[model samples]
Target: MNLTVVGLGLIGGSLAKDLRSKGIAKHIIGVDKNPDHCNKAKELGIIDEFQPLDKAVANADLVIVSVPVNATLKVLTMVLDLIDDKTVVMDVGSTKSEICKVVENHPRRKNYVANHPIAGTEYSGPVAAIEGLYDKKTTIICDQDKSDPKAVLLIKVLHEAIGMHVIHMEAEEHDRHIAYVSHLSHVISYVLGKTVLEIEKDETNIFELAGSGFASTARLAKSNPDMWTPIFMQNKKSLLKAVDEYQKNLQEFRDLIAGDDEKALYNEIGRINDIRRVLEGLALKRAQGN
Candidate 1:
């Protein structure tokens, strides 16, 4: 298969590397607006060749787009002009509702599969991509029923081959769930990092006092702001709702601490602990393939 990965950033580069490593695609090509990214992707062996968008899509059996949320619709519009009925186009953007709505009425919408693989790190660029990055990850396929059956099946098979478990979801539902889980986490991390930097202006010595808890919580702050800014904007309504809820929870905890309500604080912490238990159970289930 001739596969073309557009953007050549973290997700796109990772996909190209995995597809090539697994021998799933005979020829893997890459497309990127940034010449540096193209050169780096080629050097990293992520793709066999780098070409212009038109030529890449024209010759591709599968086209995987991994760009920012705001850029997704535009890229899809351009790809649609070049792709044929047999070509399978998939996008790995964080936000899906807007993109899905934009392409809903397009004549060749069946060739497009909207996918969000729940995997990534606080990094970007082709150099940051690693093999097996998508392995054991849960990939959400939004509005699969709206896509062509063969195209959807091919995408599912590809994701499975790359060690991802597929889950079907409506675009709106995916946005809502990810807002709380993924988007809200990034918001909190960014704010926390800002707060800490304000207090400890000395970046060199701040790490001496920072423990594992702080390190873990602030890890997402290192993520690419360019990518996240558009995602937060695209899902503004859902993200705002999530932030409001988080603020309310934080205020409640503050009030408990102020009043020295030991029992209430303990109970609240215990309830959250239950969430950890639930997550641990889910992890175990996934490991056992249950």
Candidate 2:
């Protein structure tokens, strides 16, 4: 397949690397607003060449829009408009509802698929593009029925080629579930980092006092704000609800701690501990490459 990647950042560059390495995509044409990223990706062999968006998508068998959520709205539309009937396109935006809704009535709507691959790290740029990032990860293809069957099949083949498990879902449902599991966690991480930074002015003290637990919890705080800010805004409604619930739980825990209700606090901890089993199962599944 002749693939065109709209953004040569982590997601797009990673996808290009895996697909090219696995022989799924014959050639990759990169398109990015950043010339430096495009050059870096080509230097790293993530993409074969770079081109303007119009020229890139024109000859592509498939185009992957892996830009930020806010930019994806415009890029995806441009890709669809430029591509021929046979050229399929997919977007890797985290929030799906807004993206899917905006292009629902487009003339080439059937040529596009909405995807959110449950993979990534607190990094960006082409240098961060590594092979096997999608290995054993879950990718949700939202509103599959709305897209052409051929396009959907091609997208499934592309993701599955990179060792990802594909599942179908509605766009709205994907956003709601992702808000709690993904978005809320990011909010917590960023805030946790901010809290620590504010309270612990001494960098040496933080480095000495912090353990692995703190490091892991605050890892996502290093993620690119350019990407995450748009995601938070796109799913604002669902994220607000998730944040509200999280605040309520935190309040309950604080009240119990303040009131010296040891039994209630212990019970709450015990109940939350049950998540360990679920997390273990998930970890096992990923380890086994399910």
Candidate 3:
């Protein structure tokens, strides 16, 4: 297969590496606005060659776009305009609803598949690309009914090739769910990091005193703001709802502690501990895939 990846950053570059390593694609073409990423990706053998957007789309049997959410709609529309019916276009963006709406009425909408690969590191650029990034990860294919069956099938096959389990969902639901599970995590981490940094101004050894738990909780704070800002903007309504719920929980916990309601606090923590069961099940499913 002739596969073209439009953004040669972490996700796109990693996909190219896996597709080539697994012999899924005969040729991998990359398109990126950043010359450094293009050169780095080609030098690392992540892609066979670099081509302009139109030229790449014209020659690709499959086009995988992994750009930031803000640029996704524009790049998707441009690629859709350039692709033939046989070309299957899929985007791996964080938020799905707005992008789906952007091309809802497009003539070539059937050729496009919208999905989110629930995987990545707190890193960017071609240099950050790694193998097995999608292995055992869950991929959410949104609004599959809007896409052509052949295109959707091709996407499912591609995801399976990289060892991803597929789930179908409406774009709105995907956005809402991810707002809590994904975006909210980032928001919390960023705030946590900001809070620490603010304190570090007065306490010089604040970071030095940090433990593994703090590092893990603050890790997502290191993610690219350029990528995250657009996602938060696109999923603002759902994200706001998630934030409100989180704040309510935080306030309740604070009141419990202030009132010395030890039993209530213990019960709340115990209730939250139920997530361990859900996560353990997901981990088992992923391990079975391996």
Best by lDDT: 3
Model 3 ranges with Cα > 4 A deviation: none
User: Would you estimate the TM-scores of all the predictions?
Assistant: 0.97, 0.98, 0.98
Residue range 115-204, candidate 1, lDDT tens digits: 999889899999989999988788999999889999999999999998989999999999999999999999999999999988787566
lDDT tens per residue, model 2, 1-290: 89999998899888998998899899999999999998898899888899999898888998999999999999888888888898999999999999998899999999999999999989999999889999999999999999999889989988888999999999999999999999999999999999999878755476677899999999999999999999999999999999999999999999999999999999999999999999999999999988
Mark the regions of model 2 whose C-alpha exceeds 4 Å error after superposition.
202-204
TM-score of model number 1: 0.97
Q: How far does residue 211 in candidate 3 sit from its true spot (Å)?
A: 0.8
Over the full model, what C-alpha lDDT does candidate 2 score relative to the true structure? 0.93
- Native-vs-model 1 lDDT? 0.91
What digit string (tens of lDDT, one per residue) describes model 3 on residues 122-213? 99999999999999998999999999998899899888999999999999999999999999999999999999999999999877888999
User: Model 2, 109: alpha-carbon shift in Å?
Assistant: 0.4
